[model samples]
Target: MSEPGGVSTGGAIGLVAGLLALIGGPAAFGKAGAWLADRADRRRQSRADGNREWEAKLKAWEAELDERAAASLRQCEEQCAELRAVVEKMRFAMVLILPEVERFAPSSPLLQKASSLLAEILPVAIKPAPAPPERPESISA
Candidate 1:
């Protein structure tokens, strides 16, 4: 049915619907945009929290590694100190015994040569060799 103004009932309904859509479209779009922004903010905060935790763990791991390295360094220094002390004691003993060793060695040119060579080389060797037996008959030529 047409109204007196020649507008049908369906046309009047369509006009009203179009006007409502125009007015409400911007409001609905703004709400949806705000919701999306809030979601993105939440995600960003979550990532930041994860990053902070990772950083803390990395720092702790670094501290543990530093402690281990410091302990190893201290142990190595102790070992070096002990080795120095032993060396010093051996050097003192060598200083006391060297002259007697030379004097008591067999009075032969070959034996003297060997003894001097041994005295020169002993300090540098890892361990001192046992002294040769002191039998005159065994060394006599």
Candidate 2:
């Protein structure tokens, strides 16, 4: 129906209402869209934070492992040095005792002297190997 404005009033009203509905619909959707975007942003930020924390923990564990390894290596070196010193002392004692043994005979007084010397020196010349604990059942009757 024609109105004083020279356009159909009902059509004009319908067109304006349709435009407003279209624009307002998107505006309502914008809130839900923004909420979803905020949620995604929070999830991404939390993941990044968790990754950073895990990286820090891994680095700390690696550093601790390295420190323990270094300490163990140092302790091993010290024990090796002590063992080497014992081996050297045994070698020196063997060197001192051998010539005396070679110069003596099996039944002579000199041989008796050499045997006495060997008995005194042998324990000092050798480092005994560590023995395993004996089982009572394995003992000879």
Report the number of the highest-lDDT candidate: 1
lDDT string, candidate 2, 1-141, tens digits: 798878898898778656756777767467656887999999999999999999999999999999999999999999999999997797676556555555443346764665566567557443223444667875845
- Lowest summed lDDT over 10 consecutive residues: which window, candidate 2? 124-133
Model 1, position 131, has a per-residue lDDT of 61
* Model 1: per-residue Cα lDDT over 1-141, one tens digit each: 999999999999878656656877767557656878999999999999999999999999999999999999999999999999998787667655555655555465765665566557466532323566777975785
Clashes of each: 0, 0
Task: Tell how far residue 75 is off in model 1, in angstroms.
Answer: 0.6
lDDT of each: 0.74, 0.73
Candidate 2 whole-model C-alpha lDDT, 0 to 1: 0.73
- Superposed on all Cα atoms, the candidates' RMSDs to the truth, in angstroms, are 13.6, 18.7
The alpha-carbon lDDT assigned to residue 26 of candidate 2 equals: 66
Candidate 1, overall lDDT?
Answer: 0.74
The TM-score of predicted model 2 comes to 0.56
